[model samples]
Target: MTSHRKSLARVLAVGLAILSTGLLVAAQPGWAAPAIPAAQPVAVSAELTTADADAWLDGVLPALLEREEIPGAAVSIVRDGRVLTRRGFGLADTGISGNQPRPVDPERTIFRVGSVSKTVVATAVMQLVQRGQVDLDRPVTDYVNIELPTRFRTPITLRHLLTHTAGFEEVYANMILPAGTPVPALRETVTAAPPDQIYEPGTTPAYSNYSYALAAYVVESVTGREAAEYLQDEVLRAAGMATASFAQPLPERLNADLAQVYPSRHQQPIPFELVGPWPPGSLSASAADMAAFLLAQLNTGGSALLNQQTLALMHSPALGEDRLGGLAAGHRMALGLFEEDRNGRRILGHSGDLIHSHAALQLYPDDATGIFIAVNGSGARADSATVLRRAVLDGFADRYFPAAGPGPSPVGTAADHAQAVAGIYGLSRTPQSTFMRAYSMLASVQISADDAGTLTIPLLTDAGGTPVRLAEVEPWVWQDSEGHHRVAVRVDEAGAVGAIGVSPALVLLPKPAWQVMAAPVVAGSLGVLLFALLAWPVRAIIGWRLKAPLDLPRRDMRLRRITLTAAAVIAVGVTLWAGAVMQMSGGFSAQPGLIRGAQAATALGALGLVPAVWRAMRASRQAHKSRAVLATLVALAFLGFGAVALAGGLLLPDITY
Candidate 1:
């Protein structure tokens, strides 16, 4: 969900934006530079020394936890193919009193690894590829009983799935089934209501949890064991990750050791999360055990699960473009890894975010050194988890892998391009063919180019939480003032901006003007519709109370009542359903009863407008010219509102988030 969460998170951001100011995108805060990592590691008698790691943790971690209100975290450091540090800081759980807390255990406490599970799944697939039982280039349907049903004839392969280029549109609805609820078979979870194949297979990159779930399904088919069992018996056991388990609910025996994930320091811990698909994420492991896994990965040929050749293939850039999805600047997607060229050195890693838990695992395959950290949580803070994860890795890089300079400064953009990249960009992981498309507007990013050729997007804040101003460094590439982040826009042959970034957070494309402005437009349309519909009965009552003799035609009056009745139903039905959907964004059952009924009522109301319009036209032909003109205008307005609502898919039957 770390990747898919990026898309859904955009929707929540908009709600906050609407409250903060009108007509402005709020800047997302960025990770503050972490405290310095251990100075150049010195081997003093070969036992892991706490001097360097302790310096950073003592000076930085306590303040970080206090500032972000994060409860606790577990960190593991591996260097030169040996475990260097395994430590936990802060409270793992606070029994009841906010004043009392239980400390996390680095050696035994389990943390949900979230999408880090993808890497393990990738490892499993590679294991089969090594056995020649799975073909990386073959269509996925060969291994799983499912068809991509894509628009193009290009059959999606395991390579495409692992690299997230299979073109599966992300569907967040019912993605996380209840913990106590039964989990469907892996095949059923991956295949049911398959994502719409928006792009050609092996084309543009899109982050997808569904793709990884399919990867898990493939593992099950090949190994003749449930994926969790295969992962436990084969991957986890072979890698020496003794304390790890892909088992959902974590098998009660291990639950006692699981760290309690808090939504925020102030909130109570959420009960155990049960991932329905059970593939993209669900693994729980301890920091100490993860160190063993990292050591095995670093030891390539020495690894029990994979050969050096297979490991190399997994770490190389399997999917390359100008840039990669959801990765930092100058990076590309490589199988399950994000390969980045940082300061002339290459590293492969990935980050994962479950609802209450977040994790990052990265390693310099060549240097055989890396850091892994998982936080209980930083509440609803936007970039707190990122803050913790990157602090550990960035600090590690700065200390161990020093750079020559502060990297290159940004380039400049053409003066004409100032307006070329201006517009609202929606997240790429949105539903392509569902009412859920409206959710994209919530996750949109607004960009404007000034006459001075500077790009003004409230992209991210520095560690200090101040917005970072960005300007064009090279054509569509924009660099932050700190030069810490870069965003590149993809322009089509026609010179239209196709996409706005290399990373998923910045990779949104320009949305339609109407779609972007739907906030005010939809609100206004519905406001007018409700006003006119309610005025119908109000006007009739007023006229009767005034003892006025209605000289209007009975047919016209009857038509007005019929249309008003339909409009009332439309307004009420949608209002109730929308309120309910907003209140419960977590899970929307497949069959939305009242929501579907709302769709039917709205459709009938739209049809009823035809006769209403005709009557208003007839009324205009009568002597009461002023009244008739007003009626005509109201009818026309209602018709216009209905047309806009339908086109925008505001009234679609499948109202699942």
Candidate 2:
């Protein structure tokens, strides 16, 4: 047998071993797991099959339009390394009238696969790991020489970086370019600042662009090549994905059938130039090519990209207790690839999203089944992908692969109550607000009842439309499938809900609620102070001759006014910061490092003012002294703020809501 067939045989043998073990485990007394049906044979075919696949698509297409408001989409299904279906509907480019969206030709048409590029990058990184060129546990600073501001109490590892547990803030807010502004370099774009972080490294899982960008940087540092070039040569080319290419500024000649990407919500055609960080969310490929990539990974079990042992390490989830959607214990991110169990089957895959495109690739190692979908239009709902996946699974579920049995029903349904449970609930002793009105707390609950009349309370989306099911363990507390739990509501004497409590598992205890609220206020106040400080020189230049009540030089009068404004701003900032700390600390002493650092900085700046004032007084006695001193102070302040801003930009985590 050829290597491919031999590899297939070995996979089947492993599948059989796992299935037998699972059967034995299921037969144990008191183990009432759901029955998983046996796998039915599917006739292997070379040409694409549309009959059943099209039927599945038929149900999915309208649902996409109704739920996601997506005007059009394209989907493809692959079985045993073969493309079974490739179809498309609706307009690829919404701007052009009378232009019907063409069918997705698997041999042609490039669709942007967003974060899925992370998987490819992960694959490349794993390859380096396999070659002993990179260590997963090492500090990322070892790979890149840039000094990261040390707010993290614990050293950050590569695994922490990949799993998004490094406490990085979401930094993709300004990802897209507005109108005619030049697109900044990927590194520059990712490191822009303003909003800083809430916690230190490894404290929480906040999805970030910086992590992936850093991953890309690691690939470059290890391989001595740009991430795009390395991915194209190592992963794509090795997997026989010829049509795939990383997004770049130069537009390459495309095959006639390339799918046009449209802007989300607005439906404008999205140009490649607009995608800033290519490694994070900017790979273009056809559906067939995507499927081939998946097949190569599953069939070779990472051998196609790296050694067998490294592939095993990549498939092994490093997240021990940290939970990701649909992923169980022993299942987490390896490099960029996510390994998880769907129903009873072990699957390895990743999802991709750009502003105008959405794609998914799933590989079922045991059954040799692979599914890939790519959409060209913007505003494509995430539900569309889920619905399509369900349909595809349904096609194979009863006929080809049946469930063994129902697993244990998730615990308590009491917290779920009903749609009547759906609403904005208020928490007692309301905390101060950061970005919005204070004294009010809002929590949205979405309740969906299953066939058994058991209420399933899931977190509601921002739009308040759908209910995401939660995992039940206790009577009043509920956890999302991903393990983020919410506490049950208790009504008080007036028959009104008094406090909606959340369990400690969901809340970050690093800072108190009031302090959390005050941080932004402090930051904003500081910003205003800095702005006023900056305005001093401009005011001196513009209002040079203006006189005020004070018997001072006109420029000195301007300086005094600006100084008063800045001092007032700084006072507010300090007050808010101190108040927040007092409230949040709750008798718990502040970290000595953080407290001392802030105090020292403040004291230094304050002491420096003695010299500054004396210099200003002397300068004021001389002509243009006030203006020159004001200019000097403003320049110094700008430099300080710029340094803090840069450090803040680098330290902030990347998260997506």
Candidate 3:
């Protein structure tokens, strides 16, 4: 791995360990959505005895809380319409010693539920569909006033948005808006930065917050009500989730019980996260509140939210193979639910993360059981939360609903298939057309093969980055050592591996050597730029030390010094300018003044090298020896850096989005 790859891996790990708060977890291995076919969600008759289920959670939840240093967490188990064990384990508001603290009340204390709001919002859309007021297959423009910009001729429909096949590129603008910012209406926020459709409608799957915002926009326009209002009356309230509110900041009545976000175990709590598009990820609710929705899901519409038929359709698979980037074999996309195949049994659920808060809601309809986990704090080691959550859920499934039999005979771990899948893989969620896509290098996703013939995917490793050897279970399907997760590879027509689906939420594909190698070039070239900036003064000191003056014409020496200084200044100034832009909110969407200055400086830096190149050439021909050679290197290095900056859009003329 190169320096850039290491740096990017750290960035990706922290980013994923956290999924931009543990969302789409472009960073951590366990955080990704592995492939599971969508076709198998069923309503088989199954049940869980409350005593065993409650005993298991009682033994596990606190142990995880203690081991992981998670400040507060709530777990709810709903068995056949009965709240089995919905309780809190730690403090909800661990206020600073000088500040007032509130212990968690799982039944009443509300936590920011993250993207689980998508599921809730989807239910609202299905409710409208049930009423004949909203058609899932109808084009969105038919319901909303705005038009989605698309390269494809197919129109985006409500059904496409529901299944996440609306094809809108991911948009993060004000998605997690900064504190103290006024919350914008859902429609205003979606229209503010409408993402272009990167694929034809229903042709691909990309996890997007914007898609749901548009779906909510359609819901609002059709009903003449905002999303929060509609969800409050139609979904949250009807499902008996009284403690749940889709509003960004909780309503005044519920604000007092709202939980604060903690980025680290010991760091002072951060301010309330204000999301502009509340529909996508802004719901704040208690574990008990979330259970009501789960109950509805497991029972297939016990609430007035939607009819049983619409609810079943909402839970049914929307896309099968996920044409763009294949999802895990047994996982599939439904209206809002992610139907997961695990342990020879099926589970439906969704996970949410906004950095400081993490949540997972799972429903096992066959067993008539569902589980919800919400953690109130996060840190660099946030993968602990994911592991803990999955452990409890998988443990419940195993203990309560054990696999009927053993899996297929395991092929040797070090099979030819393992060697074939080996190599560097990059996250598929990367920005393809934008320079922001350059950050994909930071992901540093890789799969290495051991002599055991087993493949080790580092991302799937434990918190310590120790990889797990995976055995090929079937063609293109690899199972983890623990059998808890699996990877499905997609091959092109030539039968070459094109991409690997870890889950419906993420896909990994081979990264070209040039891209992996670009990091070293960037690092080495940047170092040269710094040296060029220092050369003139250093050379002057050398001359003073020897008590000698320059032998070259004053004009040539002056030109060399001046041009080198310009190149150095341009390079350093642009770097500082970009650093400043990165500090500001929404810098990715719009460049700040420093960034513009850097762009201008990079251009000036490129031109500054011309005189230095001429001086070096003149000196070289005259046998100036070392001076000419060094000058030539400086000029070339400056030009290389400038070209890279320009091409990569690191500097101003290309700054506008």
Candidate 4:
């Protein structure tokens, strides 16, 4: 008996250990561990036309500011080895009591270049690769002596670190500790508790600052130097970015011309210390300095910083097929930069955003055109980088770089028609009840001209108050400096604002007063009903069946049959009700609205079956007999359909575009 007990104890202990191991393995985030390819040679030269490109940059600067509501911005356009245009505009600090308000001057003033610093870091890493100091494919663990959690499937590598596929959790916001806390060294942060796995390594792609932080540590370990020091010695100096430095404390030399970074909405100065993970976003420099760096990148293959082959590898996408934004097709990542084909032209670029700064640098290798923008205010949204880049490209296409002649103005008859055409229009309610909830509250304009018109429209903010001015981009299209786009308002024959048509991409709209009042109430009531029905089985099991079913078998049998019949009827009724709601919303059409309603209905219907199944099982058990599970299964099927409909209805707006 003692021997048996010992054997059982051992089995139990082993099972517990296995369970713990399984849980640990389940907790680690996924990383992409792709094999790094052999470096490919790339031709580098500084010979490209810049005349037309310079003119385009000049015209685009103001237009961009007007569209994005950016208070101040510095822009530089570079082609081949030449600087096309470098200019600045607006006030850096808008607040009255803050530092002196200054217009952005690309030549003299330094501005935080945000995540574009990643490019510099990438370049620095490549320099190490060129020198044969670091192996791109080697596990980062080989360089650093940090005890990582056992859950990571494959070891993280330099390539994974660069491409942001290092299975690290997005810990940027969380990494900002309170001012006085003992800051963990880079190694401590990398090997910190692993986050839960969203997917297996290489199967999922998520942007993570942890990867960059880890890479920074790897750089330090390999070079026996801090990340900032290595970058300055290896890349910045070689690229001729003299004003640039990764020092988080703001180097004194560049402080005099440093643009005061401001919070966009509140008009407050941004605190520098809050900019966490310096390796990714700590660098600051002037537009001219950045332009010089662009020129250097375009010119020589064997620069002191990185070889042309390594640079090419850094620019190529580490991930397959996935493109950032809709900017390009088959887009891929290089060390710190992204490479993609835009309009049949291969383009290389990086965008950066810190607490109170936004910046982007793009190079067209074929056209030898490079565009850079650095904003001192965090007024621009994250997605605005793509918009700004596209606008610059559009201006470039018009030969507006060196101030090409403006297109013919549609000022007279066409303008009037466009203005008249500009009005609020809303889509009629669909059978699926997919009409936009905010249509009645917000307004859009229809312009008299197709492309040229200047109009100011009011926009509804989050709070139910007055609308703010939004500058018109075209006759009907309006956008703010923050890249918020809207349409022109149209008046009907009755002169009343009837409906608003916003971009199909605009998911959040001003909720109407009625909708605001009704939505929560409806959602709450439905949710409660769902929960109650689902809980009925458990409640019935604990309350009545267990106690009486075994003691008074015949009576229990009768009671169980009755209970099962009642539960089935109720389930059928709920399923039918859900079906009715779905039908009212619309049939299972392919439209997003219908799909959402169907999902909701399906969820409701599926939940209705729990009680029925519990009752049937209880009855069968009490009588020691078999019964068909068909009714419960049918209820579940209906529930699934309802759920699909509901999800489709809720998410319709987001998927509409």
Q: How does each model score on TM-score?
A: 0.83, 0.57, 0.84, 0.53
TM-score ranking, high to low: 3, 1, 2, 4
User: In order, how many clashes per candidate?
Assistant: 5, 27, 33, 69
Model 4 stretches astray by more than 4 angstroms: 1-51, 150-153, 175-184, 193-198, 319-329, 380-390, 397-657
- The 10-residue segment of model 1 with minimum total lDDT is 19-28
lDDT of 2: 0.48
Arranged by lDDT with the best first, the candidates are 1, 3, 4, 2
- For candidate 1, the clash count comes to 5
Name the top lDDT candidate. Answer: 1
Q: After superposition, how far is residue 556 of candidate 3 from its true place, in Å?
A: 4.8
RMSD of 3: 6.2
- Tens-digit per-residue lDDT, 1-657, candidate 4: 001001112222322221111000111133122121112322232222455445555567677665665667887877545776787777666555555666777788788876677777777777788789898878878988875433456666787777655544323122233334444555655565433333234323334555677778878889998777878877787778878877766767777777876655345665553345556666888898898778766543334555566655555555442212211112335566655223224556776655446677877654556778877764555334335544555445323222122222223433453454444322221112232222121222222234444443332221122343344433323433322223323334554333233321111122334433332333343343344446557756876865742333465446444434443443453344344333322111123444355334434344544554554455546443433243333334334333433432432434221
lDDT of 2 by residue, 328-383 (tens): 22233444554434444555666665544667666666566667766665345434
Number of the predicted model whose TM-score against the real structure is largest: 3
TM-score of 1: 0.83
Model 3, 1-657: lDDT tens digits are 011112222433332221111112111233234433223342223346567666777888788877777778888888767788788877777776455777778798888877888898888888888889987777888887786678887788887887677776544344456667778877777777677676677755556677888888888889998777888888888888988887656679998887766765566887777766667778888988988888877764365576666766776666545444444353556788676556656577887776567787888765677889888876446366666666777777667665544445456543676777788877654444443443554345778776655677766654344676666776667766445567777776666777776555545668887666645555565566577667667867888999875688887878777787676667655555445334423212233565566556667777777887788778788766888877777777766655555544454343323
Candidates in order have lDDT scores of: 0.68, 0.48, 0.66, 0.49
Cand. 3 Cα-lDDT: 0.66
